[model samples]
Target chain A: MSSPAQQSAGKPVAFVSAQALRARMHDAVNDPHLRQSFRGAMDFLMAKRAAQFPDQGELDSLRSLSESIRQYSLSKLPDLLEQLEANLTRNGVQVHWAETPEEANAIMLGIAQRHAARLIVKGKSMVSEEIEFNHAMEAAGVGALESDMGEYIVQLAGEKPSHIIMPAIHQTKQQIAKLFAEHIPGVDYTDNVDALIQIGRRVLREKFEVADIGLSGVNFAVAETGTLCLVENEGNGRMCTTVPKVHIAITGIEKVVEKLEHVAPLFSILTRSATGQAVSTYFNMISGPRRGEDKDGPEEVHLVLLDNGRSQAYADEQLRKTLQCIRCGACMNHCPVYTRIGGHAYGTTYPGPIGKIISPHMMGLEQTHLLPTASSLCGACGEVCPVKIPIPELLIRLRGEANSAPHANPAMVGQGAAYDPKISLLWKLWARLYARPATYRAFTWLATRFRALTPTQQSGWTAARTPLKPASRRLRDMVKDRR
Target chain B: MSSPSHGANTPRTYPSRPQAVYFYGTCLVDMFVPEAGMDAITLLEREGIRVIFPDNQTCCGQPAFTSGFPDEARRVVEAQLDLFPGNHPIVVPSGSCAGMIRWHWEKVCAGDPALKARAEAISARTYELAEFLLHVLGFNRKDEGPATTVTLHTSCSARREMGTHLVGRELLARLGNVTLAHHDHESECCGFGGTFSLKHPDVSTAMVSDKVASLKATGASQLVTADCGCMLNITQRAAREDQDAGRACASLPGEHLATFLLRRTGGSPCGDQK
Candidate 1:
């Protein structure tokens, strides 16, 4: 409240505090133009997803399959990771392990330094963004650029991806055209979508050709065949992984599956749930660097598996469900809060429903506790998750973790970060009052008797609503009167 | 295939309609929307099923349960566990409260063996009012009221967790005198997420405004909701919106689906209308 951070498109460029988050939400709620765009886009996406799942039975079955595959793979995640490392190494690919964002950045930087990499061309790799890979590489004097059209536009604007799948979804074509006219060299103002994409591609194609290193994200890392599968509608990902002399992929450790066959159900459901596509335009699989008799490919391949608090989530039974996400972004597309406030309001690498649950582990409850409570517990995210992540249930658990007293030897970092003694005492009193029938009845009786005196300024409820007053007669009294 | 999203599509066989059922008037209904509770009981009685109002039943412990105070929630829920001893079905008029008792009690009571058993038994027998009326009682009613177009709005819990979104429609299907108007995005929440309405008022207001406008755009003279919490939020917002637009407040009078059905069936409401 003291220092209002710069606002763009009705959201804070970054979240500073819990108060600022609400302030940002207030701005977002009142931004009619932004609200209309988000509303229309979310509606279009919800319809597309609904159309993809014409058969409820099919959706249920596929969701179940994807859920089991992820759960089964995560159950043996340690072994599968070791197996994956061994298999990838055997297939002439180098595998690196990173436990934190700093470690992940250092490892990637070391690889960049080893290759004497001056420029790195990137695809739509959220993990790279999560570790602030571009900033890290640039600080080390290695130029890193985005090849994904949406990501490129977001980068050019010096902003974070607003949504996961469609990074620039929050931006209007006019905004992009204006951004391009001001930033892109020799580019004129144009609101045409095709023309804009062509301009971005032309600029990025040069980067791909001259870059020393290419970076991409893995959709599914198959341990059985030691392959990294990438699902993309655009060919930019293929170019990033195959065009350069050295290809490097980064992803969370949870993306690994045990068998090649496990990828099918996940791939099909992810595409349909993500963009309403039967399959992505390109489903590129990279088993290793260019083979001995290969046609055209990178000479060396490296994979970085970043932990970054996933292990904390996997430590508990119920919390492990957070890792089942397939990065489909369907949950965000269906979330009511996301539709209203957009994504940058969260100020996390991931945004919306997934961010609410997962950000707590990555950033700790101290920073991300407010994210979980931002939802209405509407179950839209969980109801639409392609992999059955049980998002609502996980959000509830994260809330408990945030508010509960952290005992000795807590499982998560920054546990009980949001706990307040006053709030705890309040719930205690409420429980005591509600647990006893006599107390509750007497309370209701007094409340109804003094209904006229009930305050209209009932905290925040009366902000845009009429005050809720008790009825003259409680239901218990009404039943007795009828009798 | 068992999945969280498709929990609604899973078919559930109903228990045989029993002679007596325990009525769980949620705290919201008990204090604020008592008329809805009265109408629900009257409808059940008219079906020849004796309705037992458990005096000790205060709440399903949802507010505390969802607000990160599990110990407090469990204490409240454990007390309600003793109110219903036998296997006679427990009927709750609100889908959210019903969902908590039916689906979440076992999870909340996961620590204790005896508590878990009792929670499972209670869950197996609990039903939302509309779901019980249609599925168990095979409720059929003749609409003897005037022709009024009305739109039905349900809570997220009712639509997703309880899968009772269609139950209200089915019950209204039997009321020939009433015309049901469709609203845009009917399944979306009315932003009455109990404490969520209080915690984040601005976002909650925005969501409720959209809901009220959508229901109004249908040109329905009246609104019916399955949950009183949503009723509290939507009706108040509708009235406030009307007052803001320089019109008489409460023009689109909102009522519980139970009350709407009862009045349509010629059953006079027992409580005074506010």
Candidate 2:
């Protein structure tokens, strides 16, 4: 594994290489525990997803509808943002718009200042990770607490979530037991899944009590009725939103839906595609905060709508649909590359198929130069995508974008441009030549005919497989003779 | 749903009623393994389908288009439309090519007003071979063969693009005495993304190496795949490992779908059969 210094220096992480990661997976994935965990988890999720759709045929219809919905949302984003803000404000909630991460962090810090927030409890949010919200909060003298089980595990380990939906998908029970033994109090180290959950629950309970401000990430905020929906398995998001005196929800601007009705069908696809679950264990919808009849809910609510390069992503014709993502993590779960290496190998907040697309956009290519090239571009992510983002296509585009970024590639031992077009162009021409049969054969014939002149027994291509020993009869030659 | 006798039916008397079929021999089988194309036609003819090879067919436009040369690829699309004019239900052996023709041509060709109609016409008729066999011909494997264990490496282009995994399995099941073992990461790409291997050989080599390793873990002697690109990579990797391990790698080998099915069905390859 490459050290954090290598990462900070903008050198590519070897452990994060798609190739090495895939290789590592082929060995470690076969372990009984990992396989069993994967099988059990995937099966449970798939079952839940299948059960959600009364008829399987509805899947295609839902996908098409969801695509249209997302397309419309992107097309009318400015209007939707105004509408969402107006409605949220009408419901007695304060809404702040942050155009960049720096601005978003400042806005969040401002909220913490108003509440005199010493300890802030948080629900799982990839957006929060996008801005490194925890680090910023700590820097501003607010101690942040992650309540989500997976987030909590990754937090303790000082690593990013390997998988988006299952934040701690990379860590084994044994690893967690060790982490807990070191971090959590009064627990004998045990690899028991139930025991670990118990430890997390107790630790989170105390944070909830002391937390003056609850910070949560919005899955979707409906503009029409001013409703915010959060889907979670651990039930921590609800406590974070409701237990604290002041509740604040943060999300990317693209997460806003046109109406509440749009949430139901999309949620159907989201949960199923994400974990194969028919429905999330908890689907909490908050309209403002405390109501007249409501027993338990936050007294004051605030929403921070984050742009943070999303506006730029929306401007790109090919990339805009990436906003359609519901963060279901279906693409990751089904992704062959992701399942093997787990998520931490990605070294970003968002891991897997969606991560490859969103990471560079969120973190800037300088910091996330490697995430895009991490795909095989097999188009598997496109196939399983519920809203049909054409993920592989976006991944390719991101790679191109990364090449233009100043720090994408390490400074060539000194100062210079990271990538050069002339070198890439020559490489492209060589590829085009090999791809064409006539050209490939002509080149092969020239090389093989003068075999003695060529290097003998080279290691990579030549040594392993014998080169096409000049075909005794070339097709063109045979055709010419026949003519 | 054009009938056999509906169009220009130049039927040759081979002692059977020829069921009309359109040949969409993919670029791989066309340029590299022409034998697979020949064998596919032979198999179809044996079951009474008169295969029509439209000579005007250029490429499926997959290679150029995937490489981001969609404008240049439009000419190839025009040539394909000229080759097969209407709905003849063209059957292709390669999954990626079939998928490109069936799904992408219409979309890529949508910009050109002249090619749009033809692209739409061809997309409706193109079918991958396994899909044509199981769904169209209703052919299922029911015989017994030499009991050998083999693992099926689902090519990414086939699994994600053409929906060939289940259909390929259904066709493979007909071969007697063959057990299909599956690798853990079956849907992962073997990294043969056309010019991707040449342009990014290091990355391609890395992906294929992992694919070969995954196939080996299945404990199956043979790794079978439908895509020739995947076959090339797997075979190359296996051969490389065999060279390194000497006798240790002898137990495992790689084969294409045509070779595998042909062997099991008691039909020798054209080179060997005669």
In terms of TM-score, which candidate is strongest?
A: 1
lDDT of 1 by residue, A1-483 (tens): 000111122332334654367778889999998899889998998898899999988888888888899999999999999999999999999999999989999988998899899889899999987887877777677877878888877876778898999999988999999988877778899999999988887887777888999999999999988999999978999999999999999999999999999999999999999988888999999989999799989999999999999999999998999999989999999988889988877778898899889888998888778778888899988888988888888888888888998778886788898899899999999999999999999999999999989998987799988888999899999999889
Against the hidden true structure, what lDDT does model 2 obtain? 0.69
Q: Tens-digit lDDT track for model 2 on B207-242?
A: 676678778898987877777767766776677677
DockQ of each: 0.78, 0.19
TM-score result, candidate 2: 0.80
The per-residue C-alpha lDDT of model 2 at residue A26 equals 41
Candidate 1 stretches with Cα past 4 Å from truth are: A1-19, B1-8, B272-274
The fnat of each candidate, in order, is 0.79, 0.12
| Stretches > 4 Å off in candidate 2 | A1-55, A185-187, A291-296, A365-370, A396-420, A427-483, B1-34, B44-64, B67-91, B105-111, B115-125, B132-151, B174-191, B195-223, B248-250, B260-268
Q: CA lDDT of A117 in candidate 2?
A: 85
- TM-scores, in order shown? 0.97, 0.80
lDDT of 2 by residue, A1-483 (tens): 121211222222223533343344445444556545654565465456546656645776788788788887778888888898889889988899898878888998998998888888899988888787877777676777788989888777767666678877667889999988877657789999998899888878978998899989998889888888999888899999999989989999999889888888888788878876778899999888788888988998989888876876787777787888888887776665565455655666677788878766665665565556556668767776888788876665565454432453431111112246664465456455544546655665575456456654534344333332332333233223333
Best by lDDT: 1
